[model samples]
Target: MSLHDPAQLMDERRRLEGLGLSVTRYGGAIGLIGLVLACLMGFIQENGMDRFFFVYLTNFIFFLSISLGALCFTGIQHVTRAGWSIVVRRLMELLAANVVLMAILFIPIIFGLHSLYHWTHAEAVAHDPILQHKAPYLNTAFFLFRAVIFFAVWIGLALFFLRKSTEQDESGDYKISIRLEKVSSWGLFLYAMTTTYASFDWLMSLDPHWYSTIYGVYFFAGSAVALFATLSALCIGLQKSGRLTRAITTEHYHDLGKFLFAFTIFWAYIAFSQYMLYWYANKPETTGWILRRQTAPMLWVSLSLIFCHFFLPFFGLLSRHIKRNKSLLFFWAIWMLVMHWVDIYWLVMPEYVHQYGEIGAAPFGLMDIFCLIGFGGLYAAGFAMWARGRSLIPMKDPRLAESLTFENA
Candidate 1:
């Protein structure tokens, strides 16, 4: 059968029964091992508990950002009614659904509240006027309430989209697509507000003395970069495993690479904008956050991000050939994913050092590795579980035809 034949596209390889089972088995095992070792390291090392919570939060946010990015793009494609993405939209839905798993993973951060947030200390709040001023929004009860609301919105949106998209697979109903487009319109608004406030509450409040109006956008930009990189990598991995080989063509990958490239610049733009504003203003509260990263070991990390995160990938992915070539695109995709982690590490690890009185010391260590592996393994397992018995592409999407034959102009 020809590769373009719709009748033969729904082959046995399009489903993930065997692949999903294997990924689930190994992914779950590795996750358990990583989590166990991370726990041991947390207790066995000095100030281990504190380090544990901070690193845990860092890894949690890193993975969470990927899902948030997936959710954002899923809504975006629907809102725009983009046809080029239908061939790969199922992967985005699968990734977005992992937000449920991320919610469960948030439990550790809740327990570490007192250790992670200086504002959580009653004594600190009493002494610091700034903390007192921010008290209403930063209090533990309100923080928890906001977290619940955030998760509720995310879970509801994720499940709704995933459920509806999957239903269309069985029902072959184009009206479901219309319903999704309608939901995505308002869903994006809720996503924007929740993501912004969540970033403020979870990350910005770590210091309690610093604030940035654009921090949420900064986070969103990096998440966008992560999302595109993830989708590209996953699609390549699936093709490599001999699944979705026909449905997801080079054209789909070309589009994914373009997104990855576009968002890499977007992330850099937002990052530099935030830094430039703070630098120009020279305000102590705002400058303090940037200063922490500019000093010592973190200073190197900061400089590296400018080059590694932006410049290197920016040039590497600039070629049209690179975007369509599976091997090259996969390399940049993995490269961007690593750089995205570094970006998150730079945002987070400085605070961990500043809090522990290890201002000059680099925070890199075995625990960071352990936490990353732990979270990563679980993330893979969740993705695999979601993929089980499901089509790797939206086999019946109204736009699938357009996507399958899509070509760049």
Candidate 2:
């Protein structure tokens, strides 16, 4: 803790002096191929751009959630001024920074807005009372305006913290930390508003007649948990590549595991709470959405989520011994990530399929995989490029010593 300990500080810096991260090499190729294939599949698909936009929306939210979750993670660290996460915070910063790229990626969704939301149809809005009632907020012009504002708020906050954090790594300015803390505190309220309304605009309005007050919070829960799994997997993979092998220790991974475990439960709680209240009230409008997921073949996916998303991880990650084990924890992290995808897929694909008087999983078909690969490849590549520009850890953070030497009791 002494300012006189120059040699000790230099040792820590040397450990993170080189981080081997190159996304453009292999990752760029994968992204290019996936997107091209997705485009080809889009053109080839039957009927309009409906199928293509539907696929895009599913994948768009999937990747966007992880980015926003990282934004939330960055905001939390800055606000709390937490010491334990300094070693791994840069990974999260890079993820949060991808919010810029996601906004650009969201352009296609903007062009295809009419394809995804029923309320955007003029004739349909004219005929349907519900759509008419919601028209003041759900009109295309206002929709695009909200989308732009949401991206601006998220991107601005994301860049500010990331920029300041990188600068502090160079200058070791203590004031930068204090400034980030203030920005992060104010930024949390902005994040909540943007994400909530954005979720309603993007996801909830898919079922035009359906409404749920907690849907945005539901989106937040899944997104945050997904980021935990992502960070855990990234750290393990980087360690395997001999990057940050010593810098990010098992203690950090254990905390990551704990978060993954905790939020898996939180996601389930929000999910069930939404369903339980809706089920009890028996409102035809809201209950229809849940029923579509609960009845027939769709119910199979719902049960699968209950087991995979909640129970499996719940019991599997319950032990402190399991949390501390690297390989076992990585396995569960992958499981939770897959389950999160399934969870979103269930939420989205059912409405798409119901248009044809059928409801189920992947019924809209395999373009889902293609778009996922496309966006996932692009998102990962952005993460790598961002990480390549800086130290793998926040090497000069005042709390770096605490994080590097962290222990879990």
- TM per prediction: 0.98, 0.94
lDDT of 1 by residue, 233-339 (tens): 99889888888887888888888999999999998998989999999999887889999988888999999899999999999999989999999999999999999
Tens digit per residue, CA lDDT, model 2, 1-409? 2223223544443222233244645566777687778767878867536777777888888889988999998999988989888878888888999998899898988887777887878998888887888889889999899999999999999889788999988988889889999999989999999999999989988888888899999999999988999999988887776566667777888899999999999999999999899889997777789878877788888999999999989999999889889899999988988888888888787877765464334464556677788888788778777666576666578877777777886
Clashing pairs in 2: none
The alpha-carbon lDDT assigned to residue 307 of candidate 2 equals 94
lDDT of 2: 0.82
* Candidate 1: residue 347 lDDT (0-100): 80
- Residue 243 lDDT in candidate 1: 85
The candidate maximizing lDDT is 1
In candidate 1, list every pair of residues with a backbone clash. Answer: none
lDDT of each: 0.90, 0.82
Query: Model 2 — which ten-residue stretch has the worst lDDT?
Result: 1-10
- Which predicted model would earn the best TM-score? 1
Estimate the lDDT of model 1: 0.90
Per-candidate clashes, comma-separated: 0, 0
